[model samples]
Target: MQPISPIGVVRGGRRQVHEDGWGSVVSRIDLDPAVFDVSATSGLDAYSHIEVVFVFHLATRTCTGTQHPRGNTDWPLSGILAQRAPNRPNHLGVSVCGLAAVDGLTLTVHGLDAIDGSPVLDVKPYLPEFAPRGEVRGPAYAGELMRDYF
Candidate 1:
């Protein structure tokens, strides 16, 4: 597989790995000037939201293959792939955040879960056409696990 590199870096948000209270975090994603031209974000403002794909650089890798969500035994045991924990195989994260503005190579967003200094892998406009087509369902525990995850 080809190696991946960051297109940008997150500027502000929770610096720690605490899972809750990410709803109001505002962040700036500054694209690497050497890697991309300012025009890279030219028409991105047309979309109300964007999908930010980033790396969980701070999560310590763990060997446990399965665990209760958030370490809560009340939730059923789930495989690492079945959960959204950052310590999974790839340590990658994706979040859909409100697009506040696009200025040159910088993008201002709301509710981005990535922390300051996190490497941003990619950014894509949120297109409703790509939404799930059929009924979406998951275990009840998953809902509680994301109750405050934004």
Candidate 2:
């Protein structure tokens, strides 16, 4: 398989990684002009939200075992895949955030958790049809961990 390439770069958000308090952060994703034209985002403004697929470019670890979420001992240990920790293999992160505006090839978004200068792999409109079916359940700790994550 060919290696993945970033279609855009994040800007004007948190400069460093933080576990929480990302609710109001506004960011801009500038699509590479060499690869994308303004028409690429022509119809994207219709969506109220979007799902951003980005690389955790600063993640230094590739943990593959069970660990407490956010190093909080109060939470139960879970496999790397069970949590959204950045230390896992592949360093991929996905967030469904509010779409603020789409200007040409530049996108302004709210609540994106990725840091400034992060590489964005893809952006997709958030569709309710793609949501989980039936009941959805998770450990109580998951809610607590995401209380301020937006």
Candidate 3:
């Protein structure tokens, strides 16, 4: 497949991910004003949340095979897809965050799990109908890894 261009860049926030405070951490997704139409975000504020698809632009390398999650041996080894590791083949990340506000081509959001300067590929309003229909389940190790990732 061909690569895609970023619609915008993330800004105004802590440069690194923290173990906590994501709920209160505020950041901005600034769309490329030249290519993106501000009107595209006209009704996005109606939703309380948004799904941001971004690129892990800061990842130093790509992982095409299995590796310990977070480099913690205590967690079982698993394929890249089994964990939310940033070093994936495509280096893509999707985060659902609370929509704090929207101003023109800039969006202020809370709980976005990406670092500063991350390239935003797309932004979709969060809708109830798109949520999972059944109970969500995952491995025990996945829980352990996320215990402090928030």
Top candidate when judged by TM-score against the true structure: 2
Poorly placed runs, candidate 1 (over 4 Å): none
lDDT tens per residue, model 2, 3-55: 78999999988999998889899999999988787788888999999999998
The C-alpha stretches of model 3 lying farther than 4 A from their native spots are 1-3, 17-20
- What TM-score number comes out for model 3? 0.92
The prediction achieving the highest lDDT against the true structure is: 2
Per-residue error (Å), model 2, residue 130: 0.4
Per-candidate Cα RMSD to the true structure, in Å, reads: 1.2, 0.9, 1.6
Cα miss at 82, model 1 (Å)? Answer: 0.5
lDDT of 1 by residue, 11-113 (tens): 9877887888888999899999988988888889999999999999988876459977788889899998888888887899999999999999999999999
Per-candidate TM-scores read 0.95, 0.97, 0.92
Better of 2 and 3 by lDDT: 2
Model 3 lDDT on a 0 to 1 scale:
0.87
- TM-score for candidate 1, residues paired by index: 0.95
